[model samples]
Target: MKVKRPGLVTVIVDLNFLNVFLLIVSFFPKSKFIEQFGFYFNPTPSFFGGYN
Candidate 1:
């Protein structure tokens, strides 16, 4: 059996996306748009725990 790891570029891209998302979430913590869509989209309690 063999397992293949993700490519370096893929990992970097994913991290970049995560950073951007966190930035947006942090900036708009109390915005109406975030309140309405963030939970619906992310639905990760821990991800939002720090902000609240």
Candidate 2:
């Protein structure tokens, strides 16, 4: 049997969730913590690119 792939809606929803999460973290004084770990996911192109 072939494995099913995620739909476009699923991919979009996941990205939106991540955006909201990062936005919330950016408001906190300890956002540096998020940045430190976010590097592992290469968030710079999406998150930091928009903010900066």
Tell me the number of clashing residue pairs for each predicted model: 0, 0
Cα lDDT of candidate 2 equals: 0.68
TM-score of each: 0.43, 0.48
How would you encode candidate 1's per-residue C-alpha lDDT over 1-52 as one tens digit per residue?
8977679978999999999997878765556777676443443456656542
Q: Report every candidate's CA lDDT.
A: 0.71, 0.68
Residue pair clashes in candidate 1: none
| Residue range with the least summed lDDT across 10 consecutive positions in model 2 | 39-48
lDDT of 2 by residue, 1-52 (tens): 9977679878999999999987777666445576677533333445546733
lDDT score at residue 39, model 2, on the 0-100 scale: 36
TM-score of candidate 2 relative to the true fold: 0.48
